[model samples]
Target: MTPMQLDLNLLAALDALLEEGSVAGAADRLHVTAPAMSRSLGRIRRSTGDQILVRTGRTMTPTPYAIAVRAQVHALLQQVQGVLAPSHELDLTTLERTFTLRWHDSLVALGGAALLAAVREQAPGVRLRFIAESSTDSPGLRRGEVDLEANANPPAAADVRAEKVAETAQVVVVRPGHRLAGEPAQPMTAEQYAAADHVAVSRRGNLSGTIDDALARLGLARRVVATAPSEATALEFVRDSDLVVTAPQATTRRASADLGLVVLPLPLDLPPASVYLSWHQRYDTDRAHAWLRELARTALDAPNRRA
Candidate 1:
């Protein structure tokens, strides 16, 4: 018979007939009606071009061919069942994998050390690589080039899946002896903040951002003297000079403390930055991928000095 004409169900019926040696007995074994089993047997006969079973007096007996192939058919069915079964639980200790994460430089500074420590404790064989966030839609995650992307603002692609790992507020930071640092009150006013020269952090090197938009609405604007490519760069400029730098609390706490910079609440009402861990939907069911995703969520959720 041609491959197109061959039927899997007919093969199953053939196996049952060879084992049971009677149409009624095979029907009972397959949990099918006698008529349905007979039809299946007829199809199997036509496909195989064999009598398959013959009746002698009142009992049926399999042909030489059916007896020879019965064991092979049973083994084939068993192999198919094994192929369709679910995967077993993953063992992290023995699973060796490498994960690539893209993010802003500040996150690598603030939480990168802690995140690496946490992951290494359980997944010793796993390695992590961090890259900077790209400007345009690179589709790295979709192409399986990047395993994860963590940032305050993730890409807007609908195909990308994201989970909020932490929430951070923007705070104003400056050198120890900056004019704003000597303010009597803890939180300076918007005018007091606007009066100082600012250093803005923009990967694209743009001198303006949400801070500018917010300041304009208040009928006041800060003088942005310089634009740095990353948060770390902006913080460095803030440390040596009098430029006021605004940064996310979660990722800048360590840097600010190390630089001996003064961190203050933002004078204007700005929305808190929502930090997210994102991945392509392709890795949703991957056990190793799921383990890493959970590891990231746990690390970000756990209380830190800033929180």
Candidate 2:
């Protein structure tokens, strides 16, 4: 048999009655007459198939069923309100909100400086909350804890909005005055490339990725001498040793003068690594949210990109 649905009005009336424990008080709270409140409670009892209330000497008492449904009832009401409430447009100049962003540290080292500068110029009152996790995507965006995910290379996901924020080529970085300084990077031979011990970058202690796979296909591979989580450590290692490292071109260029590293184009058919802007569809049209995304795009500043 199909169940007949009761009006939500009765549920609201029952909630007030349960809260006050007095018929007159519940009526006053709901701005209804005592008789009207009583009628709503009667309807609630029929719909629930329970004797939800019993009269005490001066007040009403809830039955076990009423107590069981109270929390669920309130939760539903809150959801209804959240759905109907309007999302106010943010005023950038005076708006103060914390936006959480997740990304791999490689991006932070490469693009964070420029990204922050752009945000500061546009929204001075905004604060950044960042998480540096290599696998920070999908679940992070859906959970609302992460507003953006910046990745070294775009990961595979369906319906995820992403675009190239920046284009970076894999460059062999070496310290100045090193044994291989000023050597022609272009037209590099696979044998010359694999000749040096490489410092690999990763969040995990393990050090291997697409670059290694490509090298293997060509019957050549570089020796990974060490692994680090961030570019800072990589630069530190390069500063004191002859170890050659491959990193995104932007990061290598930015730290070249300071860390004394120089860029060399990879000889084999290495694909261009691109940094992507990834976000969920939930905030697809949100104006304030889009503004932040634009700032990130601008900061990345791809050769043919707009934020």
Candidate 3:
């Protein structure tokens, strides 16, 4: 790899310029003179080998290159702030900032209530928003659109930081009084599970998944009659219908109240899956972020006993 040399000041200037899309606007945002901003922009253009922003008619337009690199610029800025502004301690009691987080609806049962309550109790000013589970989280986090991801089997990359937040097993769910609902005296058997029509949660519209794999290894299989984007939607589909839905215990717990469903341990045995909290490594030591991660761990693992 070619050795790289970059000035932190230049990166800051690039961040402002990319955000505002104009030298003058960047200068204003940075509280510097327009001429000074133009000079910094010139440096950026030379370093990047592209006119990061070009004047288009009455407005300054960011080139595709600028758009592509803006998120990196923002991340670099965040790192710089963390480094120079680092302290031995953090004051979250008075910290007021909105925190963006990504999670799926299924976790609502197990982690949601605790996560929200913990945030309120500790960092009262910190709020969260959920990202669609089916969407890729890296680009969104790197772009600063999402701060962290609550997910499973998170990507293992140099820039990614993931912490095991919870552990859960998938279980079969059906409405009360169904034929199979009361079929087993204990856990349902593999053959019995295979006979039920399942509603699958898949992003690619495929109707079968890991449950099939587990069953297949045991020489069994399930008949899938439906596919859905989320467990909530799947449970809703099977609410009053005769179809069965298998999902994370969290999902069954959350949807049970509204859907009036019963949770059954999957007849087939499988490893308990770990749910993780992930973020860019750049934020691993961030004070606010640290608080968020800590709270997430406590919230998610408290009831599950998976910490």
Candidate 4:
């Protein structure tokens, strides 16, 4: 058959037949009758001059030619579907969607309210779901389970796209009456900072982090008395006790102020924590997804702008 006479339906049937490895199975998958699928297979064999699936004893096995072209056929089908899909202009007033965001808890505390308010004002039908980050790596983004992610760590996946939206300097947080809080005008030395007990914020429950590494380089170390699962929880530990926690300045500013804690400059040298917005490449051209990403970027940058 010439290229002009090629049938797209036959390509889909061939893909299913190769994947399922049985005529009956392929018919069931495509919601067609057995004889109808068999007739399509016969036409495919004549068109390609190859018996795509040959009967072996009781089961049907793919021929070498079928195995080689299986992936190509599936990919072509997807491309055709994408090409034929209708494009609809985004109508925020009547559009309804729920976007799932898996962000660091501190980020949620920093910008969740603003993002929600903006989305509600612009698109009353849109909803936001703020999920807590998992202690271990998850495939939620790759599998399309999570719509977006906001955190300091950028994903390493090749297909995932990450954009750095903001960065915040690290600062030390202490209770109002703590020794470090008393000397607001004085620049606390590394030795003085190391002398205080510390609380670490680690989702994985580890006591040591970048701060520990920086301290080690300076031949000093701080004692970590406890570990909190989130920065917000760590700030609570600092609010009522002498334990100090080093956190991103912008993200924790509001929480520290509400808790009546004092913020001090970190004595050790460390890079600022970078906040990245990550998503799968599949949503690159989705209009609604693009709208939400812009709002998210603005919300994340708001704290830094205020500072």
RMSD of each: 17.7, 10.9, 4.8, 6.8
User: Could you tell me how far off, in angstroms, the CA of residue 144 lies in candidate 2 after the best superposition?
Assistant: 1.3
- Candidate 4 weakest ten by summed lDDT: 74-83
Runs of candidate 4 exceeding 4 Å displacement: 1-81
246-289 per-residue lDDT for model 4 (tens digits):
99999889888888889999988899999999998777888999
Model 4 earns a TM-score of: 0.75
Candidate models: Cα lDDT each: 0.81, 0.73, 0.77, 0.90
lDDT of 2 by residue, 1-307 (tens): 1134667566567767766767787899779999998888777777777877798776678888878877577545545545665788778888687888887776776667777887888789988887778532346664345788887656566645777777767787777766655455535567777877888877676678887888899888788989987777888888888887787777667676676567667766777777888886666767778989988887666432421
- Per TM-score, the best of the predicted structures is 3
Estimate the TM-score of every prediction. Answer: 0.69, 0.67, 0.78, 0.75
C-alpha lDDT of candidate 3 relative to the true structure = 0.77
Instruction: Write one digit per residue (lDDT tens) for candidate 3, span 118-161.
Output: 88887777777765665433465654557877766776666777
Which residue segments of model 3 deviate by more than 4 Å? Answer: 1-10, 16-43, 46-49, 54-79, 183-187
- Candidate 1 clashes: the total is 0
Sort every candidate by TM-score, greatest first.
Answer: 3, 4, 1, 2
- Residue 216 in model 3: lDDT: 93
User: What would the per-residue lDDT of candidate 1 be over residues 1-307, giving only the tens digit for each residue?
Assistant: 7857687677667777877789998899789999999999888888778888988999998888888888687656545545665788989889788899886777677667777997798889999999887766577785456898877776688868988888878999999988887755665889999999999888777888898899999999889999888888899999898899898877777778888888988988899888888998666777888988887776665534348
For candidate 1, the lDDT comes to 0.81
lDDT of model 1, residue 66: 86
